[model samples]
Target: MISQEQNEFLTQVGPGTPLGLLLRRYWFPVAAASDLNNTYTKKVRLLGEDLVLYRDKSGHLGLVQERCPHRGVSMVHGIPEQDGLRCQYHGWCFNSSGQCTEQPNEPEHSTFKDRIKIAAYKVQEMGGLIFGYMGPEPAPLLPRFDGFVVDNAIRVIGQAVLPVNWLQIMENSMDPVHTEWLHGHYHEYITTQNGSKQEVAFQRKHLKIEFDRFQYGIVKRRLLHGQTEDSDDWKVGHPVVFPYMLAVGSGGLGTYAFQMRVPIDDHHTWHVWYNAYVPGPDVEIPDNLKEVCVYEVPYKDQNGAFITDYIDGQDIMCWITQGAVADRTNEKLGTTDKGIILFRQMLKEQIAKVAKGEEPINVFRDPAANQFIELPLERKKHHFSEGFASITQRFQTKYCPVAQDLIALFERVGVH
Candidate 1:
């Protein structure tokens, strides 16, 4: 257990805080590219700061303070012009760099616009998502992970706003044994209660679990009841990519996905399930797949009860029940929680490194090395013997807009 001070040190993410400063060094997704299609502007909250994301007529992206400096009005209603965003209240225009450029009502000889500025950060778009960097100057390049840059692939984005801290959601990725209970036994019970005829496939007891500190973050391996050392699950397990993302899914001819846990603030988390379905070379990807499909995952019913039907929904139920910040001071951890303990230690070490004026893990710089960053994941999953139909019914993929079409795609490619 840790003290309250230690927990706060790791949890608090406001401006100038230790964790906040460290998080600012990396880029986080602020909005989906399609979110600004109709309105061309979005209000975003990250690390306890309110900001506005907009696209100008000249096809440039910008993230600036939500409030205008002239009259403190919201910039969400600002107009997107050829050069910058112009406030609707008074025609005050600010460029992408947060420099006020035009004040229509000001005197022709006035220099007030030159002296006015507001907070702004760099924004970039990749794979249908817009990411923002609020750190110091000389920002690092946005990482081009395999799922985002791969060719002949279909992608979809599913998001959920959880009323919990981002740290707990990340800690869930490290706990391997929870699958046996939370997603296995509890899953069986919930399905039975809901009057569903399907049986849970994750009932195997875990024999042993291990974690290793890799260059990216931590790679977790698990040995189940009937698995051996020769199994791919033990040889090349999946990884948690640095501070925020968990990379999961099967290898060769299967799906690859990333679970991005974006911190909205101290008490809220924007959880994104970014998935890519890459089939064999025998198949031809459809032309309509150029634009990614984005949807919101439902966690609660109309009656306000938690929805535990799918895998991600069940995980959300547990994370939200842990309270807003998860009181680690009164919690008890066991031997099976070795991975969680190791991850906490890693976080502290990285925090200390940043405190000493050094770069932490997963900050990319070299463009040559950043091209197509491939993560090593298990070629075979433990429950994959159940086949592709299992994935279509059990995961968030069930709600995908192209669910039936993808099933047909796998059939045509003979991947099942």
Candidate 2:
């Protein structure tokens, strides 16, 4: 168990905190591209800072402080101008760099606007998601992971804002043992209670689990019941990308995903499920597949109860029940908790590195090297043989807008 001080150091993500400083070194998704399709501006909170993310008339993206500098009016209702966001309250305009460019109510050619500025950060669009960097200047290039840049792939983005610390959600990614009990036995029990006749696929018992530190982040491998080390699950484990993402999915079936956890604050986390479905060589891609479909995955039902039927819902239930921020000091860890331990150690090491004013892992700078960085994954996942239909039912894909179209696409590609 860790000390209360250590837990606070790790869980706290407000600005100026050690862990927040470490987290700020990397980019995080503030809004999906589709979010701006309906409305140009979205009020977002990241690293405990209230912010407004907007798309100007010229199509440039900007993220600035949510409160207008002049009167503290929220920029969420700001007007999108050609070059910047104009506050609806006083006609004060700020550019993408947070520089006050215009104050229409002030004297013409006045230098008053020149000195006014608010917090603004650099934002970029990659794979239909808008990522913002909130750290120091000379920002690093966004690492183009394979799932985001793969050609001829259909993309879908699902998200949920959980009232739990980002660390718990990320720690869940490192814990392979949870899959056996949580998603396996617990899932079976839940389904049985719900009176569903569906078969639970993740019921397989794990024999062994291992963790390895890679250039980007941790690689977690698992040996399941009746499976040897030769299996792809053990041989080519998936990666948990440093700071934010867990890269997973079946490589053989051309289905890949990234579970990105963006810290909304010290008490809430924005969980993103980014899935890419690559059709077979001979399948004709549909025109609609060019755009990423975005949706919200519900973790709770209409009756104010946590929905634990699906895989993601179950995971969310556990994470949220751990309290707003888990009390790590009171926890008991075991041998099966090695992955969780390693992840904690990694976080501590990275936090120390940031404290020393050094760059942590996965901060890319070289453009050439950033182009299409591929992550290792198991070729044949447990659900590969079950086809795309069963796969959809197990995860958030069942809530996807184009779930039927996905099934049809896979069937045409002879995946079924």
Candidate 3:
């Protein structure tokens, strides 16, 4: 167990806090690229700072401090012009770089407006998401993972705001033991109905889980009962990217997924799950595959019960109910909790690196290395299989509205 002070240092994310400083050093997804336009500006909050995001008439995107420097009015109501965003209040205008460009009412001789400015960060659009770099300048290039590199891959972006600290979500990515009971045995009991068969075969299986260091981050491996060293799961276990992303699952409908979590503040996390559907060699790609599908994955039902239909829904249910920020100080951790302990230690070490004026792990500056960086995955079994379509069908044994929406989509596009 940790002391209260340690817990505070780990959880608090406001300006000047240790964890906040570390978080600001990475690029965060604050809005969907399709949501911003010259006609509307999106309001977003990240790392406890409120900001206004918009696309100018000339097609340039900008993210700046929310409140106007002149009268402290929100910038969302501002008008998007070719040169800058004109504040709805008194026409105070600021450019994409956060420089004050104009004051309609100011005198010709006075340059007062030119001297004012608001906070602005660099923004880049990628894979249907607008990412903002809040770190020190000489901003790092966001690494291009396999999902972004594949040709004509369909990107379906689903977002959720979970009431919990970001670490809980990241730590969960490292824990594989929970999957045995949580998603298998325990899940069987909770989701069983109509005399449906339920079994603990997964839980009863002898399993060994291990963690190893990878170039980008940590890899968690799992081996079941009599499984050989050459088994796919044993070799290509999921890789958890440094700070806040987990590239999980392989083969079938899983086909590797990118789960990213961003700290909205101390008590909330902004989650964006990227599921890329890669087409098989024989499959013909559709024209509409290039377009992104955006949707919200709400956590609850009409009866106030957490939705447990999908694999992720069960994971999210546990994260939020653990209490916002989680009380680590009064908790007990065991041998199975080594992964969580390792994650915490890694965080503390990286936070110190930022304090020492050094670049932390996974912060890329070279464009050559950043362009189309492919993560090595054991996809032989996946691509060789008939296709991903049949795999997604097995999970839909139980009827769910959201699954129906997704399954129907699979039928239209021919899931790969």
Candidate 4:
């Protein structure tokens, strides 16, 4: 666990904090491609900095300070001109490089154009998302993945605003034990037909860690031995890179999901991602599988639902409950928090490295590569209550007595 001093240091991510400096070194997702309509300008808050995302008529995307240099007016109301965004307040146009290109109100004030400029960051587009580098000049290129661009794979982009701190939500992705209990052991699976339910068993892989310039932690787990007779186990591995990016999937043909936790502020985060790969002609995709959900709620509600549902709904609920600033001193973490510990340690180390002028690790700067795999057949049958109860009983006896204890605990806590 981090001491109060470390916590304070990590949480202070504004302009000059160590954590902020390190995070700025890498590129972060700002918005999806479709979010930029004909409007050309969008107001965004990321990494505690209020900024503007705009595309000039020349078609180049730009990330610049939100307010215009003149009169301190918001640039969101600006119009897209040749290669710049012109402020609606005074018609002061700034280029993608944040240079004042035109000052229509003052043709005689050439010094105003030369003297006024807003901060601009580097931005790039990949996989239908826009990413910006908020660091110093000569920022590194965006990293690429090996399996995100495969043929026939359907790519779905979605996002949510979480009320809790970015660290809390990001760390949650690293924990594997939660799946067996939160998603499988206690919860009822909502079936399409007759509202039937099935008991799920999560199959987990041994925790493994890979170290390059940055550390990559992997947790491979899956839903196994469930109700469907033809149900193939769903394997997923979360690859957590230093800072706050998570890549999930077994590198399988039909399974792919990635999430980037971008801090909107100390107490809020924007969870964004692309999920599900389109498969080859030989692969059969399931019609019932959901690809994405976008919603809003407080942050604390995240723990009550499974990972899938949490991403869809509960995360918002949880965040909103905290009322902006989460009291970390009251948190009680246990053995199941191994992954959280590992992640924090890695983060702490990287933060220290950045403080010392050393390069941090695992920043992906290139376009991700695509991988193709055959999709499994879809199972349409639903399992009844008796079958689900039998599986639950069997799972309790064979694998985890804690499963039974948890059911009782849920009842005692009035979770029903």
Provide the RMSD of all predictions against the true structure, rounded to 1 decimal.
1.2, 1.3, 3.3, 10.4
**Superior candidate under TM-score, 1 versus 4:** 1
State the RMSD for candidate 3: 3.3
- The estimated TM-scores of all candidates read 0.97, 0.97, 0.90, 0.73
Q: Rate the local accuracy (lDDT) of all candidates.
A: 0.88, 0.89, 0.76, 0.60
Which runs of model 3 end up more than 4 angstroms from their true locations? 193-206, 251-254, 380-387, 390-416
Candidate 1's C-alpha lDDT? 0.88
In candidate 3, what are the lDDT values of residues 170-190, reduced to their tens digit? 989888788777766766776
Candidate 2 C-alpha lDDT tens digits along 262-350: 99999999999999989865567898776899999998899999988888999998898889999988999989999888988999999
- Give the TM-score comparing model 3 with the true structure, all chains together: 0.90
Question: Is candidate 2 or 4 superior in TM-score?
Answer: 2
| lDDT top scorer | 2
Which residue pairs collide in model 2, if any?
none
Ranking by lDDT: 2, 1, 3, 4
Error of 1 at 183 (Å): 0.8
| lDDT, model 4 | 0.60
| Candidate 4 residue runs with Cα over 4 Å from true position | 1-3, 107-109, 189-196, 203-237, 281-325, 364-416
Model 2 weakest lDDT span, ten residues long: 380-389
Instruction: Write down the worst ten-residue block by lDDT for model 1.
Output: 281-290
Arrange candidates by TM-score, descending: 1, 2, 3, 4
Which residue pairs does candidate 1 place in steric collision? none
